[model samples]
Target: MWSALDLLSDPELCAGMSIVDISGDGLETLGSKRHHVVSLYYARKRAEQMGVTVNALVISDDGGDLARYYSKKVTIGSNSFVMNIKK
Candidate 1:
C-alpha cells in the first residue's frame, strides 16, 4: 500500500485524486492477527493523511462479518466502502 502510494505521490503525476482498491479473502493467515490489524490501522491513517481513499472488495465465506471487519478496519477516506462477495 505504501509503495503504491509513494509511486502515486510523484509530483509529475499531478494526480487529482488517489485511491487504493484492495481485494482479499478477508483472512489473515500469516502472522499475528493483532499485528495485522494494527498495521492496517496505521496504513489507513497514512492514506487518510495523504487524502487517499481506500476501498475493499471482500471475498467472504463467513456471512457478513468479513465485510464488517473491512468496513471498520480497512476501508478509509471519503466515500470509501467495502463490497462483499459471499461464498
Candidate 2:
C-alpha cells in the first residue's frame, strides 16, 4: 500500500482527494484489528500523496461472529456528496 501511495505522489491523485479508513470484524481470521491498522496506514499515506486529509472511520460489534462491519465516507467534487462503502 505504501508503494501505491509513493506512485501516486503526483499532483493528480492529491487534488481534492481524501483518504478514509474503516474497520469491522466479522468474517474469518482475515477480519482482525491488524487489518484495520494496515488500512489506516495506507489511507493516511494516500491522503498525503493527494495533499488532502485522512479520516479514520470505525465500527465494530462483539456479537459479529462472521458477519459484522462498518463503513467509510467518500466525498467528491465541489458538491461534496457522500458515498457508502459496502462490506
Candidate 3:
C-alpha cells in the first residue's frame, strides 16, 4: 500500500491518473483479510489525500470470498469497479 503512495508521490508517475490498481488475495485467513482491509483503507485514503480522483481496479479470484469482502468494504464508491478472474 505504501508502494502505491510512493508511486503517487512522483508527478510523472501519477500524471493524469484516474485509477488505482489493487489486489484482494488469500481471504481464507483472518490475517489476510485484516491486511487486505488495511491496505485498501490506506490506498483509498492516500488517493484522497493527494487530491486525486480515482477508482480502484481490484483483481481477485472469481466469486471469491475476498472479492466479495473487498466489494463490500473497499469499492464502496460508485466510481469503483472490480474484476474476478479464474486463476
- For all predicted structures, in order, the TM-scores are 0.79, 0.27, 0.53
Collision count for each candidate, in order: 0, 2, 0
Better of 1 and 2 by lDDT: 1
What are the RMSD figures for all models against the true structure? 3.5, 8.1, 4.8
What local lDDT does model 2 show for residue 34? 55
Alpha-carbon local distance difference test for all models: 0.80, 0.37, 0.57
Q: Give me the runs in candidate 3 sitting further than 4 Å from their true place.
A: 12-14, 28-39, 51-64
Candidate 1 structure quality by residue, lDDT tens digits, 1-87: 666677678887877669999888955444754453445657778888998999999998887998998898888987999999987
Q: On a 0 to 100 scale, what is the lDDT of residue 86 in model 1? A: 83
> In lDDT terms, which candidate is top?
1
Q: Looking at model 1, which ten-residue stretch has the lowest summed lDDT? A: 29-38
Question: How far out, in Å, is residue 33 in model 2?
Answer: 16
- Give a tens-digit lDDT track for model 3, residues 1-87: 546556768777735654566665544234544653445567667766765444334455455666666666555344666666556
Q: In model 3, state the lDDT of residue 69.
A: 69
The sequence of per-residue lDDT tens digits that candidate 2 reaches over residues 1-87 is 344445456565553444333233332243455553445445444555565533322233334322222222222123222223334
Off by over 4 Å in 1: 28-38
